[model samples]
Target: MISKRAQQLQPSATLKVTGRAKELKRQGKSIVSLSAGEPDFKTPQFICDAAIEAIQNGFHGYTMNTGTPELRAAIVEKLKRDNNLEFDAAQIVCSNGAKQSVGFSLLALIDKGDEVIIPAPYWVSYPEMVRLAEGESVIVRTSFENNFKLTPSQLEESITEKTKAIILCSPSNPTGSCYSKDELAALADVLRKHPNIYIISDEIYEYIVFEGDHVSILNAAPDLKDRVVLINGFSKGFAMTGWRLGYLAAHPDVVTAVSKIQSQETSAPSSISQKAAEAAYNGPLDEVLAMREEFKKRRDFMVASLNEIEGVSCFTPGGAFYVFPDISHYLGAKKPNGDTIQNSTELCLYLLDEFGLAVVPGDAFGEPDGLRMSYAAAMSDLEDAMNRFQEGLATLTVH
Candidate 1:
């Protein structure tokens, strides 16, 4: 029998869709997947080279429970250079990935019955992470009119005595919406008044922005540095998803608490992976910039093509590789097989079954009127996937 905590947690929806797509492919079907959040590009050569060097040098052993000194130093320098925030290595805790970093923070901070405020259309793991920590997740839904961003008033209204922390992911997972500096300042004004509520700033998509510079919450409200836990990793920016290396920077006390949790769990990530991540942090930006440019091109093409579809509407996202489109117009329409299209999950299943195109439904991300598609695949695959999306939607009979 599973523990109650395990029973309450939902498996990641993105992974489920990705798995289904892979299964279809194995069954000899031609499936185009837009489901995974991973970068399509290969990990940079220099980073890989570091890993090989580590192997050759026999660096394959357990590292410090927190992290290798070199990796932590690189992380500290990176935060200063990129985020304009300062942190000592003592305040950094490396984990298996940003997912673990986030989980550790939640476990360290949340007492039973504490509430974590999460914006809808969030990454699928946020709410589940809260549940695993025995904390209640309070969902705050954002709208298309506001570019799917949480406004200051909306945030202010969500806070309460039970609210222990708020998770802020700019260049967000499903929506790809980045908060502007001014927007962050407005949110900061509300957060400053509620000092008891901690801030979990997920900056995993930091280097993937298209429009402007990535803005960290600490940069927007330097006064709250003591309470902000900044989470980042090498997975997205360096195309090192398999490396499983991420780190968190917070107050020394928070870092210590998380380090203790991590010690008994994963201990340290792969020794080779830590070396590769250190190289990533200290390496050139050429490959990362190239990947960003490719993603931007895909974003432009995908948004334009999706808008051209009859019943679907989409907003151009500022960063990340995903585009969340409003597909409510097609809901309740009749399928050719006489089934009725209802919510986003039904729409996604219909698309996959009839069109062999894979996408994650918005219902899994806490918004039922939309769907998320990742453009991290090749340009040719994206082009084909969009065409398949249009074709699939056109098959629905008008209600």
Candidate 2:
């Protein structure tokens, strides 16, 4: 029998929506998909060249379980240069993308029944990771009016003695909400009072900000450096999601503990991918910058266009590639066939079936009656997807 853990865990809802869209395209249907979470751009040539070179030079053999010393040093340098945060290489551990780093962190730190405080709408994998680690996922809801940002008071209210850690994501996945320095300082104040609570700050979308210098929770209060685990990677920035290279920076003891999980589970990230990641750190960052500008343009257009549709309210995000628009006006709405739109899933399916547009329902991200539309596709596709979505919403009759 499959483990109960595996049975209970929800499949990635983004991929589920994306797969259906792909199938429709394969079946010769005209589809407009905004469900993808990855860059449409190709991996930059410099990173690819390094990976090819590594493979040719016999990098197939596994090296150290944590990572090659050179790659670890490169990540340390990149973090310091890009985020203005300093950390020793001994405080870092390489893993198979940010997912593994998060998974390992939970596995290493969480004991059964311990609570992990997460702000919603979070990346889809977070709560599952906490549950898989035998920890309780204590989710704090964020509203559409604030672009889904969590207030310090809301975070404080969620805390209890059983709270072991807080999962923080900047340029957050579902809503693209980035925290300002002052905002992070507010959160830091809450953490400072709780010495035992660790902060797992996920900065995977660091380089894709639309405006303002990227702010990190760790940078807000360097005094709590030992308590903050900084998670990041080459995926969103360098268009290197396929490479699966990511790492974490924390206290030496925490890194060593995560390293043990890495050693036992993944036996370290792929050697070739690590080499490619080093190139991402050392090579030109211009490609990623240009891509960020393009995404911002698309994000602005999509947010505005979605709001033009009747019954939709969108918050223009400050970072990341997703725009989540509230569709709560359609809840309890009657369809053409008389079935009421009770929640996001039914609404999402209605759009997918009738208009051939694919969007992940917000329920998967801890918000119902909203849909996550990714601007990760080309502008042409973005324009088409919004048109179809507008038509789809027109089919519903709501109060």
Candidate 3:
């Protein structure tokens, strides 16, 4: 029998949609996929060149379980230069990916029955990671009116004695909303009252901001630095998704705890990927900036196009690549085939099956009134996707 933990853990919802789209493509269907979470851009040539050099130099051997010294040093410099945060090498732990870094943080901090506050709509893996750590997830629903951001009042109300930590994702996935400095300050004020609670700040999408700058909770509350586990990687920003390299910066004790688990579980991250990421931190940002500009253009086009669809309202996100449009107006509508679209999941499936347009359901991210559409595709693909998406919705008959 499978372990109960294995049985209870759900497969990634985003990957499921992507998998379905790929399966249809294998059958020669013209599928336009808008469900992927990673950037569509190729990893910059400079970063790849560094990886090649590492291989040529025979840098295959593993270093410390924590991370290679060069990579850790690069991370330290990058954190201070980019985030206005300071961290020593001893306080950093590198892992397979930002995903694993988050899971490791949860494992290190959470004991049985401890609670982690998650604001919805969230990245799908968060609650599952908490569950894997034997921690209860306290999901607080945010409002579309506020751009899907958690208010300070909501943060305060959600906290309790059992609360172990709260996860904050700016330039958020699915919603693409970036928190402002003032907003982070407000959340920090609430967090200050509860010093016992840790903050897991995920800044994996830090370099993709379009409207404004990406700000971490630590920037607002520097006093809380000792308790904040700052998570980031080279995936989204550097288009190095396949590299599987990420790291965390926290107090030395937290780093030690995470390192202990990582040492036993996966050992260190790849030596070659670490070298590539080091070059990413030290190399020029021209490619990264260019990608951001392209994403901004795509974001503008997607939001405008989606809003023009009757009953669909998309909030203009400050950062990230996804747009979560409120599709609740189409709920309870009947398809031409006489089937009812009862929820976001069904609506997404209808778009995929009928229109060859693949998007993720908001229900998978703890919001059922909307769905997530990624604008990370090429402009031509996005245009075609928009047409299919609009046509799919126009055909539904609302009761």
Candidate 4:
């Protein structure tokens, strides 16, 4: 028999659906995919050059288990410059990616039966990671009416002696909602009441925000800095997904516990990657600004187009590249092929097979009546996907 943990784990539905879409694309189909999560931009030339230089310089040996001192120092400096938070290199642990950084925090902090409070319509991996750590997830339902944000009262009501941590994702995935400074402070107040629970602020999309400015929870309540483990990475901000570099800025004890896990598991993030990441954090500012501005334009275009479609309503995402729209109006309707689309998943499948446009269904994000469409594709690709999607839905008979 398989281990009980293996039995309990469900596969990532988002990625699973995406793979199916990709399969169709590889089968000589002319597909427009709206299921991407990464930026359409390529990694900067300078960052790649840095990695190549590191390899030539023989920076290939195993460095510190946490990370190289040089890389950690650069990260520490970047945090100070961007977030106004200071931490020694000893407090940082560079991991393979943001997922590992998040997983490390959970592994270090969670005990069996302990609960992590996760807001719904969350990133698909959050609850599963908690379960893998043997921690229960106490799901708090955040609503579109409230812009899919968790109120302090929701967190307050959910806290208990068994609660271990609150996982916060800003400019959130799927929904692209960002919390304001005042809103983050409200959350801080709730956490202050429950000191036993730690906060893992996942800021992987920090630089991708279209809103006025990013308000890091660490910046909001500096007094609670020690209790907050700030999670960020180069993947989204630097368009470096394949680089596999991410880090956590946290209390030393937490870093040490995670480092121990890394030592036995991954040993350390790639030596070359650590060097490239250092360059990413310390290098030119203009490239980062350009990427952010482009994403903003794309977000605006995608949301506007989606909103214009009949029977579909979408909010302008504050950040990130995804538009989550309410698609209940089309459900229970009949398609041109005479098949009835009863839910979001069936609707997504209908679009994929009929119009050759791929999108992820919302059932994975805790909303079965909506669909997630990513604008991370090129502008032309996004335009095509939207048009095809609209036509696909138009073929459906009104119920």
Candidate 5:
């Protein structure tokens, strides 16, 4: 029998759609996929050259459970430089990816039956990671009017004695909604009252902000540094998703606990990848900035095109590559064959199977009134996708 923990988890919804779309493409279908979560750019050449130098220098052996001394120092410097957060080398732990960093942090902090508060429309993996740590997830739904951010009042109301932690993702996946400094300050005020709760700030998309500068919770609440596990990686910003490198910074005690677990589960990340990530931090941000500009163009076109479709409303996200458009108006509508699209999942599947456009359902992110479409592909692909999106919805009729 499958383990109970394995049984409790659902396969990643984004990967599911992307996988199906790839299969259709293999069968020679012209599918326009907007379901992937990674940047579409090639890994910046300088970073790749750094990895090549590492290989030539014979740095292939396993690294320390935490990370190489050099990479950890780079990450420490990055935290101070980019996020205005100070950390020592001992407080940073590198892992296979930011996803693993989050999982390890949850395992280090959460006890059985402990409740970890998560805002709705979160990255699909957050609740699953909490489950793996044998903790309960307390989901607080944020409204669209508020850009789906967790309000201070909501944070306070959700906290109980059993609450162990909360996850915050800025330039969020699935929604692309970012939390401003003022907004974070309000949430920080609420968290200040709950001294026991930990904050897991996932800043994987930190470099892709299209609005004002990206702000970390640490920037707003320096007092909470010891309790914050800041998760970041080279995946999105550096276009190094395949490199499988990410790290987290926290109190030494938390780092020690996570290192202990990682030592057994998986040792430090790849040595080559660590060297490359160090170069990424040390190198200029020119390529990252250029990618951000292109993404902003795609975001503008997508948001505008999605809104032009009757009954489809899209929020202009400040960062990240996804646009979560509200499609509730199309739910409960029927196809010409008289089949009803009852939820976001069904609507998305219909778009994929019939219209050859693949996007993820908002149900996967704890919201059923919307669906997420990635604008990370070429501008030409985005235009094709928008056309297919409109044509697909026009086929359905409401009662």
Candidate 6:
């Protein structure tokens, strides 16, 4: 029998689409998957080499529940260098990935019936993580016209006595929208007034920004540092998703709480992965920069192409590798077989079934009129996918 917690949980829609695409490919279908939020780039050679060195040096044993001292020190230095935030190594806890880091932070802070403010068009995992922690998700839906960013007023209005934490993702998944320094400051100003609410700033896509600097909320509101849990990882920026390394910088007590949970659960991430992540932090940034540039180009191409589709419209996202296109124009439209498409989910299914294109519907992210397509694939694959998307949409006739 499944527990209520497990029964109430919805599977990750992005991974579901990706897995289905894989299955279709295995069955000899030509599926163009824009579903996964992973960089197509290979992990840098230097990081891989560091893992090999660690293995050869007999670093296969279990590490400290928090992390290796060397890796934690490197992470502390990284925070100081990039985010302009100061943290002792004890304030950091390395986990399996940013996903786990987020979950741990939620579990550390949330209790049953506590509310976690999540902006809509959010990453699919945020609400699920809250559910796993027995917390309620308060969804604040943002608009396409405003670039899908949550405003300071919106944040202020969403806070209630039961609000325990608010999750903020820069260069966000599902929608590649990013908050500017000024925007973050405004939100921080409102946050400063709500000292009771904790901030979980997810900066996993930090280096993937196409415009301006990646400004952390800590940079904008250093006074709130004690209450902010900064979440980051090597997955996106370093093309090390498979290595499964992420970490959080928070108050020492929060770190200890998360470390306790992790000790009972995963008990420190992979020893080899931690070594590889350390190399990523200590190595050159040239490969990361190159990957960002390529993603920028893909973002541009994908946005422009999606806009050209007859009933589709997409804004140029400021960062990350996704294009959240407004596909409401096709909702209620008729298929060639006379079936009516009632929602974005139906549209996504139609696309997958008709054109073999895999994408995540916005319903999974709390927006029902849009769809998210990751541009992290090869440019040629993107080109082919876009062509198929165009061809597929042309078959729908507005009722």
Query: Would you estimate the TM-scores of all the predictions?
Result: 0.99, 0.98, 0.99, 0.97, 0.99, 0.99
Cα RMSD of all models vs. native, in order, equals 0.7, 1.0, 0.7, 1.3, 0.7, 0.8
Colliding pairs, model 1: none
lDDT of 4 by residue, 150-224 (tens): 999898999988998999999898899999999999999989888888999999999988868788998889988
Clashes of each: 0, 0, 0, 0, 0, 0
Candidate 6: regions farther than 4 A off:
none
TM-score of model 6 vs. true structure: 0.99
Better of 4 and 6 by lDDT: 6
Q: lDDT by residue for model 1 over 203-244, one digit each (tens)? A: 999999998799988989999999899999999999999999
TM-score of 3: 0.99
Q: List where candidate 2 sits over 4 angstroms from the true fold.
A: none
lDDT of 5 by residue, 1-399 (tens): 999999999899999999999999999998999999989999999999999999999999998889999999998898889877788899899999999999999999999999999999989999999999999999999888888889999999999999999999998997999999999999999999989999999999999999879999999999998889999999999899999999999998899999999999999899999999999999999999999999999999999999999999988999999999999999999987999999999999999989999999999999999989999999999999999999999999977
Question: Could you give candidate 2's per-residue lDDT for residues 59-151 as a string of tens digits?
Answer: 988978888899989988887887888987788898899989999999989999999999988888999999899999999988887778889
Angstrom error of the Cα, residue 210, model 5: value is 0.7
lDDT of prediction 3: 0.94
CA error at residue 1 for candidate 4, angstroms: 3.2
Report the lDDT of model 3 for residue 310: 91
What is the RMSD, in Å, between candidate 4 and the native fold over all Cα? 1.3
- Residue 347, candidate 5: how far off, in angstroms? 0.3
What would you estimate as the lDDT of candidate 6?
Answer: 0.93
The global C-alpha lDDT for each of the candidates, from Candidate 1 onward, is 0.94, 0.90, 0.94, 0.89, 0.94, 0.93
RMSD of candidate 1 to the truth, in angstroms, is 0.7
lDDT of 6 at 147: 88
Q: Model 3: runs farther than 4 Å from truth?
A: none
